[model samples]
Target chain A: MNHEKNIIELKNITVRFDGETVLDNLNLTIRDGEFVTLLGSSGCGKTTTLRIIAGFLEPDEGEVFFDSKNMNGVPAHKREVNTIFQRYALFPHYNVYDNVAYGLKVRHVPKDEIRERVMEMLRLVNLEGFAKRSVAKLSGGQQQRVAIARALVLKPKVLLLDEPLSALDAKLRKDMQVELRNIQQATGITFIFVTHDQEEALSMSDTVVVMNEGRVQQIGAPEDIYNEPQNAFVADFIGESNILDGIMKEDFTAQFSGHTFRCVDRGFAPGEAVDIVVRPEDVDIVKPEDGMLKGTVTSVTFLGVHYEIIVDIGGFKWMIQTTDYAGVGETVGLSIDPDAIHVMKKSKYSGLYGDYSTFSDEMEEMNQMSEELAEEYAEELAAERTEEAGDGAEEAGK
Target chain B: MKNRTFLRRIIGAPYVLWAAIFIVIPLLIVVYYSFTGPDGSFTLDNMKNLSDYGQIFKISILYSIAATVISLILAYPFAYVMSRKKEKTQQIMMVLVMLPMWMSLLILTYSWMNILERQGIINTLLGKLGHAPLNLIGTPAAVIFGMVYNYIPYMILPIYSVMSKIDPSVLEAAEDLGSGSFSKLYRVILPLSMPGVVSGITMVFVPSVSTFYISQKLGDGKILLVGDVIERQIQAQNNYNMGAALSLVLMVLIVLSLALMKLFAGESDENLYV
Candidate 1:
């Protein structure tokens, strides 16, 4: 028997598009019956990685293993996996039942058996009465359900979904996401979903692999990736964060935003530069002088369950979400838990998320200065264009 | 309510007039001629005299069907290859295929004569090699050959247009769904390209049924087809009524062929849009 526990393993995966590296050397392992989600921003190579795993694309340098077998020569059909594309890709001429029966028919299964399996798959996807209905006759949500039935009827060992809900409306997308998770549970099949939406990844995936610029930044459970991000990219990508540039003081305390904050780890030597990443929800807003950092609320947004507050702390604008409402321009204090700060080393991948920890005041001053300069440049360009147009009008009239 | 508007009525009047004058008039002429007798009386003489027209009907139908089937066999491969070409190459190839169409078919027929005639280029080459000149000129082979060569573009172009519109992703999807080469061709490519094949057959067959030029020029006027019979009746025999009657018969055959083509293709308008 094949050792199917480690159903899919991608080692040192790398992909490039027109000389731009989309996936750096990446490694991932998906266990049998485990639901994994590749989560990242658009252009982060998460979909590229998924396509490579699905055998639609070949990695520049990597090995994809299925059940300990090197899958280099195995075509997508030969491999024990099926994909449900984002567009659904249903055969327009075929009815729902015929589409589901296609894979079985290709396998040369008996006609009666193909019907039985197709019927069963339809039932599984809750599309029982849709057998004779043409695929084009179905709504988008129904078409997606037909696509699910079509892919699942083959009983593949692993199913790859490339942002299957991305085409649906918001309510339908959410409903389908839950239904997808429940279906995966019912089938007990491995599902590797690729998506840019973090909340969808968090909701559906047993393990979330956050990627950026073709390299995986972090891979962990949803809660772990959110609560304890590995790097600055992860922290920013997984959720909203307030970053601060700070210098490590004696014994692991860092000074930033005109306040001293204690941190859990003390690896950095005294006077060394580092960046502190704290999620917006983790920062406590309070009355001035009663917190570690001083700030003024610039804007407040109600996000249904919480309030998202943009605060000007020292000169840096920090977005902090709280249940407490604060008026614009109101003075506020910022307090972070000692273990909340995530320190990141300076790397080329920095500047992707704006440098959060510099003097908050200096950062705001620089931002305002840049904004003023930008306005002046735009005005100058507009004036020059108007002058050119005036000269042209006179020339034409003459 | 909108149908009663002055502008709508004004616009619609011309179309109805045109249909009645140009289309319905000719169709009535054909139907009347089909039912008219030899003495200009309203009788079923033309219909009863179908036995006399049987040879024309059978030959035209058989030859047109044969030509369509042959053109399909030839065009399928060309269409497949052209559709698979890169964009620039496909454009260049399309231009090349359409180049012959720019030249008159009569001119092309003369060119074929130059190559196909006895003691012509083909026979000259064979004779130079010490064999007798082959009697290929005044044969059905020559007629079919000329028909297929001239109308091949008609077959290929329509098939190419239809085949090229088929999504490559659908083919790939089929492969990923475990379809081997044969099954993929039969299941996906062939079914999807039926519209083109249907259009191509209609294009080649309709004109081929009444095509007198190829049979006249290539068959040396000895080979009897419906086109030859019509030409003889109208020009040599000086029987316009008989010619018009036969013309009506051919028109009816074309209409019937069109309906048959639609039935055989079995593709809906929705399938084409998709």
Candidate 2:
């Protein structure tokens, strides 16, 4: 990104909290007027990144620059940036008008201008008539809107929101997510929002930076992140992915799970082991003989418009989606396009034991143990029901 | 259920009856006496008599108000520092504030007497600075100073309690909104901690009004507050009816002062009570 378009650049930032490194050598460039979301699961340091940008936490290793200005020693209050906290920290003593007018008042804007700006901001949030109402009297969504209005009224170059809608109910959260995106676009300010919900991030952000364990996993547009994940973590964290371990055979053919398949994602040495990730919706169900792989249908689920099928292919369970009917215990065929097969270099963090062969052996043993535990629990439940029935029968006879 | 509730009420009735007898009945008696005359005749003479009592009442009110105000001004910073400091420091400071509270009022008054007297350490130090012994004892200032010193912890504790409950996030939010430190103090900290301020004022004022011991002791038996007047009328002069009427009048004044304070302090009293 060009320096003019990029409002903030954080390079090689590292943060350690009580000897535990929370953010480690992270670099990110936030462009101007773009709604970028730091999307990740819990313990992902996404919140820490937002806090660091807000100047609440200082990095131990690197520098943060905002519009070519260094932000090394600037306190949060002195920074040009404004933050909307998760709790919507509205001044409880101030009503809606005063709360909205707070920043302008601090700036010593003329009274008439403060009034006009607050009124204009309130109208933007559709809270025009609520000037005299106490902030405590507003609903959760209203308070969040007021918080955003307050931050925006300051005309800050960068607006940082730390899970602003996480406190609302599901329906309200969804509504505010749309409202927030519209507000950001209309205001044309850089929005650095933090959220643990992948769905929210994917739906609202122009760009999503996925993070995990104090590191950036991937940074891309929603479609790019969803369609072409860079690694197993990105593929697994963003959405449901079925991974199959395979080996390249120098002829563009991959072998795995008792089947051979062609792959288009090349540039790998022959005999190199790789993990192939295929979305459940990408799997094609066809005739048993025509399919590249055959499996027994273990379960079929009707989820609104789509049908989800769980197939057991030679003791390896794979989730597949198909519109066709596949009953339990019936053998089915599954096929995938070579282009749809995403190949990732197997990672060390997957905790796979020893070599790939040992990994497969351990997986089989784990599956057997799980099955035996389930059978044992099921028999115990049956025995309890039988004893209760016997007691009822004896009482009836008596 | 009705019988069980009745039984529970019966078991708890003695404490309630005791409260009514000791607290409510005496307050009612004070009210009654304030309305009666010296000759056992029902009249508002005691309430309206204010000729001798008026000047004394004014002096008493002025001295007490001044003392309470000064005490609050002095106690706030001390209480704030104590409340904001580390746990061990706060505890030690609190114990020091509470030491005067644990000591008897009469003993503390004598201690003040020794400190404020002509040949006391303060005067001796001033004399060492090439000045004559300054007059401090046997004055209204001494009386006010004694009351304030004795009752300062009463002011500090309630205010500290209120200040400690104020969420630090509220102040940070104010700062984030671009409020300077002074504005944040005036808007957020002061208003949010009003309950403590109001309660501290009440704690200082109510007792200081009828506090005759420090006045009589420190004033060298010359200053006569309402409490002193009532004590003298009943014990020294042997005029029980006049004493009762004066006591009743004093009670009414205290109640009115409290009501006025509440009305002025605005909506925070109910929150503190709850």
Candidate 3:
């Protein structure tokens, strides 16, 4: 965390495709030897930012500076950066050693030196005995390590990884996360990782950058980002939270759900509308008579570590994670401390998320089904277009 | 399940019968005719006579090899450019390449004859421009040009399909790893496209070597290829024995050449379809 002296700076970057803006006017800076992650859902411009830093893409309306030098018009090969593509992109024709040594061989490095460096990189990625093995035969996790070794063998000043662990199974993904963090630390090269998985970002990154709709929502350490979210989007995206419309009454006081509560956040005008974020694990279950607000328990699910209960509070559903057992028909009370309630200013994302009324295990399945359906629909459209073009070719030939 | 198996056998009966009648029977007849004389007695006279047509075999091989090489040189760059184009443009280019193929080969060669003849369209244009008429028709070059024009599509289609299937991310990865344009092509693209090159060479070489019409129409009876000699023996001279023997030798030659090509393209054979 003692990082200083910016290594990469992006100034007012904007990118557009097909007359639609993919990345808005954005600005960011990376320090030396810092593990930074751009976390967002799909189509949120996270990969676009990584491409800009890797020199594969040039911003339409901004300047990029690497090591305090303007990097405009510089090609990817000439830049002191390497990227691990989303699919690993290992050369199928080459073995592991040849793939890792490709960059050095292209630069006409000595054959013996190439072999030595390639073997060292193989040892780093734990693929020392796989030098002569073909890349196509390796499993997904092994291929990912080969990609990492190939990029790091160049010894670039920066490494950009675009969702490198996304293709692995869950257990393998976790193992690789720890391995990647260790590799980044050992190499001390500035690592810029992009992924849509917030948990991965939180666990691996020294600095987490939350993005939404092509704009930066918040940027801070993982703890700060989790404990102190700036808006409803960050709070809901990071973890489960009960977001409600509240009003700031005065200094250190907020009014929401027909109860006035004391919170730590301040510096707001009197009687201003704001959003309140209460984490599911922060509140404590207690007796109904001693509770600040009373609620009826609607549903309870047995998770491994805790029980997740949904309560109806003044016709609004609130999700609570607690270790105590609560029946579906029982009325429960909840209590919160002053430090537990987080208040945020109203933003464009307010009232859009953080509602548990439609929350269920079935909802997640339905969302997955719809996503698959949408992908199938898109594939059908592409197939139809290709068929039509083929018919046109036949007709023109006649 | 038993009924389904019976039905499958019934459906495949026609193909088996057709192969017996048209393919297997004709091949047996060819083998029989190659070993017998006109008097219906086994003899090696026809096989021994093959040495007399050695010069014709050499000329045929030389002309077809030239045709195959020229077609490859012309089609490789064209297919590479087409593969790099957008989908719409690529489809249009494919149509243009196949357009010349839909017409009859005789008609296409006849049209080339009209274009390349001394007193034809080119000569007429040259006469108008006050330049001497260049002799183009009835030359070895004309026959080779005709073979190349007729078979170039076969060379282009396979190469283009293979090149277009290359994952674009692999190229970007090469660029990211400090490879320039030429290096990327030499190291990655050329090796990956070897399967297509082999298939294209085979497609062009097979037909040009055994072609009778192109050399007959464009060579104007001067360039006697193996196909023309075989046609003369079987149809005009009624010498089926010599024609069948010549066909057997030609088949052996083609098979040997294909085996050589497969040896050169050793491990890439696994991904030939891919």
Candidate 4:
């Protein structure tokens, strides 16, 4: 219902540091008054993108447009955007009032107006009586509020926050997250937030831009992205998923785990290899004969809201999160509803992958295992070659 | 745990004893000498000879202040540009700045004597260019030059270490908040780098105020400062009481300056390096 024209547009922005690509020809468009989140793990160029928009950094190649105006060479001070940095880089020398009044002072606003506006901002962030206190005297959450108040006082067209809540404790961080969303809605400013926390991104953003290794993996609404991930990385990164290798026979039918199952997918070549992902919460533990596959529960970890159960189905590991507790060493059956199975095109680390990451410990273990398997295969080939040589000599003697 | 704590305190006994013997006992002796006469009778006459040493004391204090200020001006930009370079480049600069300190100060001053005195390097080169010889050395300028050259590395090290610890996020935030380069430097960088500056001043000024050999060598034994006054009173005149009194006065002045700097900067010295 709140569709608006694009307020900012990034056209193929690319950035490199130390001869290594940090952002590879990335493009994104943000609508007016939209709360967009760039979600990724560390070193995915989310901070770099935010800096480019704030004019603290210039992309090596591509143009940035602010409301259809070219903004390539503009410095940060000249631009109308402000940023809330990580760790809340408040000036230790200034009190809270002067810190909030800084942007207006830069523009040479009137003395009375600056005070009134700073007071108004302090009240908005609920730090009304903390005007005369020094920045270092405030607590972490208080300092974070002061930072937000300082950035919001200027009423920039777009505000960039670089993991602003990352330094707070978990309870305070949750409170601040909700407070930030409310503030953005009240002020009606475009908020581009960068965080490595997926839950924070999904809970707060109107659009989530999932990035991996200098490339944008997907961009969509949170619900759509969660329900219909485009590839293996999205499926794995966003939430708990059991990604299994499967073969598509035709429309509405797929074969996986040595069993044929119904799935709501089409337009695939018969007997085509594909990745089928099902959310852990979507799976149900049923009777051993009533389900499609049978497995024994290997471990169950209590996760507050639910229990996370790891099952071994014919030497393949699958993680399931369910409210119903299943005892370890019990034979269980996993039943996936046809609509819950999401078929994806295999691109990178798709089939039978859990916690997909390029440089994670799991990935490193997989690499070593593959190397060992290759060594065993080479030994077998050498043994066959020697046997063939012996057989030829015997045949010639005969 | 209590026994372990007692053991830890026992381990520090040697340092405590060493400090008491070498530092505390000597300071007490100086204090005692400043308040008594050669006959061991309580007297104030030795400290009351202020008029005799006041002129040289004034000149020493003024010239040291000048040298300290000049060294700060030179070392700040040097350390700033150096700290902003690549780590390898900074390491190279570290070697270059510290290389001069490894040589003995006497040797270093004697070498400068060859460069600044008449028929020295500059005047010889000028005469070869068909110019008349100029009075080259034996002045306050040459003494100050030697002091500044010798003590500059002290100023550079403290400032360099502090500047490197400044968080990059703070500068970026200043720019993002619409501060231009000059305002950013004025409002943020300079205030944050004050700890470095004050420590640099302390290092340079303390030595400059008490130096006599640099002046004696470069000034050709003509000019004298408070340090020369102390040397004459103690060694040549054999008056330890007056020398101890003058040292106490100099220590008070240095301590007062340090207190003023700390009051203004309003920050503690957390990182102290020699």
Query: Of the candidates shown, which would achieve the greatest DockQ relative to the real structure?
Result: 1
Query: A229, model 3: CA deviation in Å?
Result: 1.6
Pairs of colliding residues, candidate 3: none
Over A1-398, each residue of candidate 4 has an lDDT whose tens digit, in order, gives 14478889999989999899999999999999999999998998898899999998999999999988999999998898989989888877678998899888877899999999999999999999999987878999999999999999998999999999999999999999999999999999999999999999999999999998888999999998999998888888898787888899998999988998899988889989999888888888888888889999888889999988888897777788888889999999999899988888888766535532232557778999999999999999999999999999999999
User: Tens digit of lDDT per residue, candidate 4, span B109-131?
Assistant: 99999998788998999999999
Chain A TM-score, cand. 4: 0.89
C-alpha positional error of residue A137 in candidate 3 after TM-score superposition, expressed in Å: 1.5
Candidate 2 residue-wise lDDT, A1-398, digit = tens: 23258899999999998899899899999888889999987788999998788776789899999987899878777787888888888877778998899888878899999999999999999999999988888899999989989999999988998898899999999999999999888878889999988899999998999998899989999999988887777877777777777787765677777777887777788889887788888889998998989989888889877787888887667887677778888888888898778877788544232122212455878889999999999999999999999999999999
Q: For model 2, how does the per-residue alpha-carbon lDDT over B1-274 read when each residue is reduced to its tens digit?
A: 9999999999999999999999999878777766776666788666566466888888888988998999989988787777778789888988998988998999999988888888887898998999989788989899999889988898999888877776655566677777767887787777777878888888898888888798988897878787788788888988666677777667778888778877977764433321
Best by TM-score: 3
Computed on alpha carbons, the lDDT of every model, listed in order, comes to: 0.83, 0.83, 0.91, 0.88
Span of 10 residues, lowest total lDDT, candidate 4 chain B? B265-274
Task: Give the Cα error of residue A91 in candidate 4, in Å.
Answer: 1.6
Q: What digit string (tens of lDDT, one per residue) describes model 3 on residues B118-231?
A: 888999999999999988888999999999999999999988888898787888899999998899989988888887888899999999999999999889778889999999
Scoring the B chain of model 4 against the true B chain gives a TM-score of: 0.92
Q: Of the candidates numbered 1 and 2, which has the greater TM-score value? A: 1
Better of 1 and 3 by DockQ: 1
Q: How large a fraction of the reference contact set does each model reproduce?
A: 0.48, 0.48, 0.70, 0.64
Candidate 3 lDDT by residue in tens digits, A58-170: 98999999989999899888999999999998888888899999999999999999999999999999998999998888999999999999999999888999999999999
Each model's TM-score for chain A is 0.87, 0.86, 0.90, 0.89
Question: Which segments of model 2 are wrong by more than 4 Å?
Answer: A1-4, A244-255, A285-302, A307-317, A321-333, A352-398, B1-20, B35-50, B74-150, B157-167, B213-225, B228-239, B267-274
Please give the lDDT score at residue B62 for candidate 2.
90
For candidate 1, what is the TM-score?
Answer: 0.87
